[model samples]
Target: MFSSDILEATVTIIPLWDSVAYITMKAVILDGEWDPRPEYECSETEADTHKSNNGSQTWKHPALHIENREKPTPESDEVLVKVRYTGVCGSDISMTHADGDRYMHYSAYVNLPNVIGHEFSGEVVETGEDVQSFSKGDLVTSEVTSYCGRCHMCRNGFNGHCENFEQLGFTIPGAFAEYVAVPEILLWDVSPLEKAYKSKDDILKAAATIEPTTITYNGLFGRAEGIRPGDYYAFHGVGPIGLTGMNVARAAGAGAVIAFEPSDERRDLARELGFEYVFNPVETDPTQAVAQVTDGMGVDVHVETAGAVAQTYPAIDETLAETANVVHISNAGEPASVDLRQYQANAAQVYGAEGHTGDRIFTGVIRLMAAGKLDNLPLVTSIFDLEEADTAIEQASKRVDGKVLIEV
Candidate 1:
């Protein structure tokens, strides 16, 4: 009966029973709520256990190190992943800095010093006795959330909104470290990596890109469900997500995918990735550019992936067609004003898209990688070790480069 909410990245845990706990971030249930709580604070023995086995490492929190004295034992349905590589995203940066009091209190209570990376790949070092679908030593990537299968949202296959969802990096400790225990249902056998990829580096790069690509896939193809072949598509903000949208739009049969990126480096990358055309919103009016590109007709589908509030309405103004379908997938913090009357009169449809819940989008990206249709390796420009997590976070915040990978 417990439910938790991670509002604005703040983690709050509410106990519905003495043993059961809920993570508010995604409304996931922790079934062993009745488990007894240890009343003791960090003991010397407990503190001693925190040191790395190598014993020569100087540790900070990974960002802020609060000791998690308890190591969770895997349940019968879980498998333990010996994490290898993890990728950081913009949201992780936001949470790390607590850009606002926004969700600070909640996150403090729940996600503090959370093993923070979500986009990751690993090997199954152990499997629960009851885990029938996988075995130890299997290569895999986790989908980042666990959901109650029987819930209304899950029954509808929108498990991302599972009334009780356990998000890996937030609700549960994630794969930022050497290991993470996840349910068997959330594990995918990525062995035969060669069967699905041309090289280990390629697969690792795909692993980094899949999470962001899935966001775009879920946003464009998932939300604007009717997007069909030959639809004109435009995406604002050619960051990782926007660039991924370029590939997705093309693959989905969009005649052309115009990427608007203010960053010259990103724009160059987008052009290199086969985006038919790329523009710098800073130098020219993207709307005007799109109009010219489309022969004065706005695009049929418009996606706003730039996490900037100021650019949103402008992007909307530029891309929406007479009967446009626009999906807002960015997580901009402030409220935005829109002229509903204009949208209504133009016969436009707008939908808000969020994170992925299951492996559908994840698998989809993997399949794309396997086919060599999506190039993710180019997107990964830097790599760092787990100990340099703080530096990685700092670099990611700058967004001056491409995706950053952490070797766990």
Candidate 2:
């Protein structure tokens, strides 16, 4: 029996008083269309108010301090998530020390004291009243980029490149906290994992790898000559994404997956994972090694996932068959200088790829895990709690092999 005006009044102060007397009384008057005094209008809960006023964590500005702020409140078009796990990305390492964030400058809500970690998975604790697609307690992950939806790119279904896009872990508040507020559209339920893995933990581990895997997927499938079963692909870099790409390319039906890596540990993983040839590009000429393996003909597809500056143009030369597609999946910031003279003679194509929604590839990885085609357990090198975030970052700086996970 609540009237619209009264309901609004009650909502205005719900965050302050948690008791039934105040709430019910407010609801009663709201039912009668009586507006509450402006002085009594508590817009945010004490927790949220504290956070807004005082920087919450010790790191304060960029790093979150939960003691200062309350768990986030969901907006009408947003959902509140209880973060379960968050993955540390290579970009995070660079951003922590970089003088500038190139992508955040392109967003609408790039503000300071921002929460900054994008690779995550969580459970839906609450939803805004206007939200209808999801309910409480749904397990989900999301497309980290937040788009304005009305923009040209978004209208055309390429939300990833929306003019007013706001990305998590960079511009806006992210999943590093105990709770995070995310747009409903960006949130995706990973509940399907229950049927896909031995347990949800397996999926969470797999989830940590999704962002990088999507980068590889988009690089290979989104724009390329096209991938067919039994195509030979040469992959540069055998880190997590490269390793994942090795399997993804194989799963997509590559006849042979050749890997180039300097780390002996990673090289072994590549061999164990079924890569046809593992080359120590640091010891021998990667181009020569790849050429030797392919009998001088060249592979059908070449993927540059390694950010190694030295491997840039050579990766192009090594992977491009007469009519091959050379895709660069990793972000190597240095300006690439190539002699234009070679362009006329080399019969090949080149493409640059970046961030992804990741759900499609994530689903594929899960399916691979379910079918026993891929193993998620072996990928994790270490796990840390939220309080150990700094320590985890410090450890990751050492470049220990495999993935580093933050167990929230």
Candidate 3:
């Protein structure tokens, strides 16, 4: 499942010594507490640690670093994955950021002091006795949202909303380290990518990207009814999610895909990816630009990856075509006012999208990558070693680059 070169670099299996293995793998960890804030209201679904309402607006990571971590052991139905590469997602950056008082800027469905990462790819090194689907040497990438297949939501065909939820990298030990134990059911085969990519590193990079692309897939197609052939669409941000969505939207037969971003680096990267219509949202009114192109007909799909709702939604309001599908995949903790009457005026609909647990989200994306329709590896502009995971997340927080990866 892994090249010999990678095995030496990622896997460090030391001789078991007593009850404590003095030599452990390295990982990026984020620690936080359940201190509540007056402005915040606790949710019944709030993580076990933060179900009370007395902390700040968000939980901050007081301690985040690359530290020694014990390797994981797979459960009866799980497989131990030797993570080769892990992408530094926006949520990782958010969880790692904190003010002088340790107040976080982003927090929802977050519980920490665990390894901080969800987007990853790896080779199966060990499988439990009861694990039937996967085996040693299997190349795989698992879902960020771990869903119990037998849950009510899963049985009802909404596996993404499974009640027994524990988000990898958020509420549990994640793939930032040398290994992760994931149930076989959630794992997706990425071996086909090995044939498509030129090298083992390249294959892992592409596989590490699968999670994000599938997320955009779920948000656009699964959650928002996708786009119609020749339907005009626009992405409000050109971050990882937006970049992948633009390509996915095009592959789904979008007539034109436009990108609106404030980052110059990201905008240029979008253009480099063959997206002809790229604009800096700060300098250009996307609504006006899109209006000029569409001749006031507007776009059939408007994707919101720009977490700045106050800034992006106004443009979405004016640029929404009739029966448009407005999908919110970005997480912005603060609320922004919206002109909801537009839905009625335009006969459009809005979708609250998150999680990539079902809807063939992983299958579609992996197939697209294998078919050469999606090249997310180019989206990774920066790379850092696993021991420098903190630096990787810091770089991601700048928002000046595309996907930032931590190669283990």
Candidate 4:
């Protein structure tokens, strides 16, 4: 048996031989206005099971239990948020997969048996004494990385590479529960952007998408030499991030935007979203198709959102304009073999664009949404109650073309 308590939250794990463990917890509801319940209990067996609609096993993570544990109290520089909506991300799927062993990569940071959601929107329910920027009831979404400002990387303006970075949903307890305590520095107030959001539902959708949209914005604007008018743009995937990238590129006045997706559902969605050039890589060579469309000039910029290194590397190399840039934003866990001479011959630049620059990208994304340049509501193809989070993750990991949200 393994039992530990940190900051009033207790995790009890009963070992069942070498391969499995049984976990359970009891938590209290903090907000007096919502539910005054003092305690609720949850067990690993009661958690959502990973079975698809077709009766096939789709998840690798063995246990995804929800606990009703003691509510977290924000530290002096933190605030407690009442989570409203949380978006399912590819990283979440990878972390929860059983056969992938992906979580091992972050085992040094993440604590097991923790809540697991990073992309979320919520209202501030309480604040610690030193919290200054936000008050209770404020609608906000926060950057997921909790960086130590004192780190060398943070001092040098590369907070994303902070030497002591603690990522939500990875290194600590996340927003999958009814409430989460977050550092005030990571919070972004979305109240000012309400004018662009028509209703509560619309705002929720925007909040759920802020994280991914900001990542896309960071890649297009912060990493690459921002999109220029009349430039040709190409995307190698049509997932949520890819869709957001395409929308951002179009809004910036790209001359032409093309996408290559293997999923029929995604292809249809790209067309429906007004993309004039959407092709299935299975049907045609993406490099050849892009070359023909650009009249042999190739694309001015290429974004790789699909995590397939083997496919994206060649596609980007073969379809890059002579002096163009390739933004490698995907998290392809494995290494890829690429012809270095192709890059040298073309003089094309390859940038490893990852997370956003926190609030800077979030504010910019909100401004774009306000100006009617970006709208991701259409990308929310599926929504589930918070209780169905496991199912939501399962659906998101499928061949779906859009976003899946959990209403918390």
Question: 87-132, model 4: which lDDT tens digit per residue?
Answer: 8887666555544431122212333456778899999999999999
State, as a TM-score between 0 and 1, how close model 3 is to the true structure: 0.89
lDDT of 4 at 136: 89
By lDDT, rank the candidates, best first.
Answer: 3, 4, 1, 2
What is the Å distance of residue 188 in model 2 from its true position?
2.2
For every model shown, the clashing-pair count is 18, 4, 6, 7
For residue 30, model 1's alpha carbon misses the true position, in angstroms, by: 20
Regions of model 2 farther than 4 Å from truth: 1-68, 98-110, 339-346, 358-374
What local lDDT does model 4 show for residue 225? 76
Shift in Å, residue 33, candidate 3: 4.0
Put down candidate 1 lDDT per residue, 73-109, tens digits, no spaces: 5789998776777887775675555323222211211
Comparing 3 with 4 on TM-score, the higher-scoring candidate is: 3
Task: Please provide, for model 3 over 1-408, each residue's C-alpha lDDT reduced to its tens digit, 9 standing for 90 to 100.
Answer: 889987775555543463355437777787776665655666665645552222235575456767777777788988999999898888777666776767765555666577878899999999988988887888899898778778888789887777776778877889889888887888998988865788877888899988988877888878887468999988998898899888898888888898999899999999988888899888988878898778889989988998899998888988888899998989876687778888799989889898887777888999888888788877889999888887888899888888999888
Q: Considering summed lDDT, which 10 consecutive residues are worst modelled in model 2? A: 25-34
How well does each candidate superpose onto the true structure, as a TM-score?
0.78, 0.77, 0.89, 0.82
Q: What C-alpha lDDT values do all the predictions have?
A: 0.67, 0.65, 0.82, 0.75
Q: State the displacement of the C-alpha of residue 195, model 1, in Å, after optimal TM-score superposition.
A: 4.1
Better of 1 and 3 by lDDT: 3
Clashing pairs in 3: 35-55, 36-54, 36-55, 36-56, 37-54, 37-55
Clashes of 2: 4
lDDT of 2 at 352: 80
